[model samples]
Target chain A: MWLRLNLRHRIYAILTALVIITISGGLVMVWYTYRMERLFSGIIGRDLVGFQVAAALEASLVHQKGFVSYYYLDGDPEWLRRLGEYRQIFKERLREAEILSDTPRQQEILESIRSEYNEYIQIKDRVIDYYKTGQRKALADVHPQLRELFFHIVDQCEVYKHIFTDQIQEARAEAHDQAEQLRYVAGAAILLELLLALFLAFVLVSHILGPVRRLTLAAEGGEGPGRIDNEITALSRSVRGLIQDAGQVHLELERSREHLLQSEKMALVGKLAAGTAHSIRNPLTSVKMRLFSLGRSLVLSDTQKEDFEVISQEIRHIDTIVQNFLEFSRPPKLQFQEISPSTVVDMALQLLSHRLDAYDATVTLQRSNPLPTISGDPEQLKEVLVNLIVNACEAMGRGGAIVIREETAVLPRVGKAAVIHLSDNGPGMSEAVAAKAVQPFFTTKDEGTGLGLSIALRILEEHEGTLNIQSAEGEGATFTIALPVKGADT
Target chain B: MKTGFDILITDHNPHVRRFIAREMTAAGYRVQEAECGADVLFQVSGNKAVDLLILDPDLPDIDSAVLLQRLRKRTPALPVVIHAFSSDMEDHPEYLKSDRFVEKRGASIEHLKEVIQDLLIRR
Candidate 1:
């Protein structure tokens, strides 16, 4: 399901799953910590209760008559021997109680028990001295206070035992409550974690993967990259870029194929034109020769002479059209030479001087200090200049300035060649027209064959030059011809 | 200029052949015409005095290079001029190891006359 999702959704789902795992892991840790704390508290409470009970029992034993008798007869031979044996038993029991006390509360109770036992021992020693001195009244007078002290200590022992029992009961209840609370909390955490995990899984599979699934369907449906949107826009962008690149490549291939087909068609046309021209040239030549000979031989009427002149002019026009067709279709072999571009421009301007004068268009040359020499057929370069100048003149119609600028600058280095830019400024073409200007037979003028620019472009390509056009609707057009400057080795 | 030599023009088109013939006649030279290589060979074999041959590079029957070699074998001294219409001539310059190459499109009648006159004078 996640694989079916788009890239963006897939990333989001992965993050969500990670978050869920992290949160669930944290909850489990909390639950474990809570359980361990509860167990520790219960053990401490049990130790405290056991220490309190042992301390109370030791206090009661110290206040009993057996304890008093054992301490008072310490000087008598038999009684002293019995008292020593009882003291040993009492010390053993006190050590056992101290060993049982593990918690801080248990240790405090054992300390109190040790201090009270020491106080009882001091009282027993005083009573034994009195008995040894034979002080009968004194022993009787101290007898009441000793009995009262003993009874008071016994009451304290009973109170201590009761408090220990109460504490033990409270601790047991707290432990039970903690256990129940732990079970509830652990169960709740597990349930919540499971629900959260399920929710996260559902979110990943539904919202995130849902759109991705749709995208996959769309892609498989052949709807292409444009159909994707929203969070998956990056994927859409990349897909769109790929699709656009492919489309452009396909379009370029189609254009190339069309160009090849057109060239084939033009080749056929050229062959036919050549044959037709050959056939027509003979008859036309004979007619012209015969007409010239007839004119030399006869004195014709004005009307007949006018008719002959018209016929001759018409034939000449047809001849010119046919010649243009042949020249345009079958260009002459290129004899490439390293020639100065300025010289070619000069020649072109000289040839078009009359037309420039008619249009009142000025030709300006802003040349580089030392123009690089380019290798090209001189005649073909002249033709390109002628065509461009003529086009500029036609565009200006009434009158406009034509600037022919030459600049020598290195293009971004591609391999080992530099590019020279020759730009022209004239009444510019619209984007739509400029795009189609290089196409054969795509004419903007009524009398134009539209072959001039096409032929110029072909000639430039033959010279390994690229022609680029930049123009707006109103702000004139600049045609920049970039020719790869020959390197030193070439 | 005594009609010093007889020339054979071999081309597929009758109009081209006639044009060449007329041009040669105007230059005061004897001219013969053949529409194909076989006709040229037949005419030459049948006792026609053929001194020079002006041929189209593309012939229907025989390859132009092969025809040139065969003609060279037959008449070692005969000067041949190849009139090529296609730019494919650049690929096969060996075939054009002839006396001269006259491009048909740009070469005027005067130019053809000059080449022939030069050849005759040189001979």
Candidate 2:
């Protein structure tokens, strides 16, 4: 029944039981005290008083005997006076005993004593009269009857005393019995109180403290039992840690969501660019053909020719823009083959040799050994290298030395990879520009298509590789391309 | 009537076809224009001996793969130069099985003229 109640109800029940027990014990104490008071008062007020009166009656009666005897021996009138005073005292004591008597038996005993005492008093007076009138023989005849009446009155007084004594004893025994009953009640109350205290302790330990201990253990991941003294404090600290972890996870989710949004925007731009470029290509080709034909067949002055040539160059530039857009929009399918990146680097350098000479740039290839073979498209890899080298050449304008370093190294997250570090002695981009360097259509050059780095990044991403650019303003830029090695952890 | 290798230029755009036909005619080759896959098929199956075919392979009616397959089955010996965006055919290598793959660009005509000349001279 106790277990069925919740913690709150159980506590209330225990406390209420304790209160009732305490109140009952207090009431029992009060009732026992009141009963004891009544018992003691009965013994002191009625029984004891009656017994005292009975004793006084016996004492006064004995005093009367001695006084009469003394008067007979000495023939003194003072003895007769003392005997009379004692007789009055005996009568007053007997009357007081009669007034104090509550039972019929006690009253009957008092009535017998009163009648016998009155007869004795008359006989004693006659004996005194005979003694005063010179009648010794008459006095001698009544003296024995007076003595017997005195003995009888004293015996009745003893009976009355015995009655009061018995009543006083009975009241004492009743008080004692009540006290014994109260003692038993007190013992039972104490035992009940002890049981209640034990039950309350059990409820506290099992229902309250037990759950708290378990919560503390769970909060602490059950590590080092009893290590923390305060379970509440430990639980609060654990909750705080959990909140912090959740906050960190929320922040990471926010960052990833932003990244996903950016990727989605890029995809939309790619689709738009592809559609626009495809439509523009056909018209653009016709214009170029017409321009070429006009340039070949028409006669013109040097200025007109320059104007014509400039128009052609601008048109070609537009075509290049369109081409870049198309390529950016339409990611080419990668043709994967087992090939060394070193070979691709050599091919790009060879292909861009004339362009490098035109830009007054120097090319340097550094490799300890042929880098490990990777599954990649050689043509696409060469295009990425060409774009990077061209970007460096343009950034430097002249006298830029491009170093292409190839090596096999273990990269974090990408494991074993063929690392290519293409560093250039050129005025590097600022932090802001470098950060946006690989984004589409972000460029610093006047004639740049701005899709070179982005396309290269995309191509490298397709190959499960990464392109990282490290640069500071006024310092040269190093573009690192890491391609995971074939049959290596990626 | 010109006395030279008969070359057929196929493109969806009439302007592009006219441009290529003019350029090829100026280059001293007999030129024919076919703006769709059906025209190219009709011309190739006809009595007019087409020495070479310059195909953009972006016909509206027929899929490029099926068009190329039909063209190949008809004229196995005739040279077919695929003229389309490089990105368009980058994923479909089957389109590159033609005699030539010319990326359509601003300077594509010059390259196309060279390919046509080479193919006709070889034929």
Minimum summed lDDT over a 10-residue window in model 2 chain B is located at: B90-99
User: What lDDT tens digits, residue by residue, belong to model 2 across residues A10-109?
Assistant: 9999999999999999998888888888888888999889989999998998777776667768888999888878888988988888888889999999
lDDT of 1 by residue, A434-457 (tens): 898987667878656566787788
Candidate 2 residue-pair clash tally: 0
Give candidate 2's chain B TM-score: 0.91
What is the Cα-based TM-score of model 1? 0.50
Which residue pairs overlap in candidate 2's backbone? Answer: none
